[model samples]
Target: MAGLFISFEGIDGSGKSTQAKQLARALEQAGHEVVLTREPGGSQGAEEIRSLVLEGDPDRWSAETELLLFTAARRDHLERLIHPALAADKIVICDRFADSTRIYQGTRSGDLRNMVDQLHDLVIGREPDLTFLIDMDPDTGLSRAKGRGGTEERFEDFGADLQHKMRAGFLELAQQFSDRIRVIDGTRDIDTVAADVLRIAREAVGVAKSDA
Candidate 1:
């Protein structure tokens, strides 16, 4: 691809979404062409799937089923948005990507990580060139997620135990993909965190500090 691909990932309410937007805006102000999009909803078809997977009951879909749905949505997103944007030499800033599915669905029950990896190899094979994993306290993250009071509570409804597990899983995944994943503390204030995120993003996109 001709463009930089970046993704923001974290447990629910980890402020990754906010950071993704901030990074996008900062990069845009720096005169970079950026496409800020999210998984499971970047394309029209994927958006429909997002409502199905994110807004329903926690038990509405099995881990295996979610893997399929997420893969389908991701395929659409890649074909319709991500690939083209990158081909156009535009920076792609995604709020979440395959890593989210790998952690959420891969470990939702037993060890489906192998299956997730195999399916990803078979379907959605692309990964972000750079990823920002916002590390946060699971307890605080769950509380913040639930307090939002939205229909996307399906994952949040899984409760604190899962949140803790997810936080650990994400950190482990960061280790596994350490070359591309950057871990950032989410406990800091928004501007501080955004400053860190923007600094790293600027570096990855090869924008000199003076240019920004």
Candidate 2:
């Protein structure tokens, strides 16, 4: 409880994963103990789940099935990796979290708000101290994702309409939790975005350290 939990969120190709890594390195360089992790696949078991969730054929996954799979992986990730790292007083920087499910699955699936909420409660019992939402246009993000030269995943293969809805979901969540979530413009230069995230993270950690 005394440790810090920070999560990075954004649409695919928003550079959140890159930013998370940079931030973790920066924190480590500053002599802080940092645990860099990701959702749907932080642990070995969860990683296998990630491959299934991302690379698996969309025809094989219903909305409800996808949600359950995500929560299952999350449960394992939280119990085996994230919680323990935080308990040991390390700064845990996660690539994504429950918010992604609420946005991607809840919004896209329609009328699943209650289900998403219940799954969130059951899986992630504690909220992160700070969450950075890197906001960007879905088209731009999709283009960037394509440039990465890898096979597109099921989520990545979603059309612009779904991506727009997903982005809107994230924005709504950020607005609803303005105090805990910081929305950063992700269209900017990578270094600039990274600097903004680092500053916010440092401030949060400073406050946490003082309170401790």
Provide backbone clash counts, one per model. Answer: 0, 0
Clashing pairs in 2: none
Instruction: Tally clashes: model 1.
Output: 0
TM-scores, each model vs. reference: 0.96, 0.96
In candidate 1 the C-alpha lDDT for residue 28 amounts to 96
List per-prediction Cα lDDT, in the order shown. 0.93, 0.87
* Candidate 2 ranges with C-alpha deviation above 4 Å: none
Clashing pairs in 1: none
C-alpha-based local distance difference test score of model 1: 0.93
Supply the TM-score for candidate 2. 0.96
* Tens-place lDDT digits, model 1, residues 99-159: 9999999998999999999999999889899999999999999999989996888999999
Off by over 4 Å in 1: 207-212
Best candidate (score: TM-score): 1
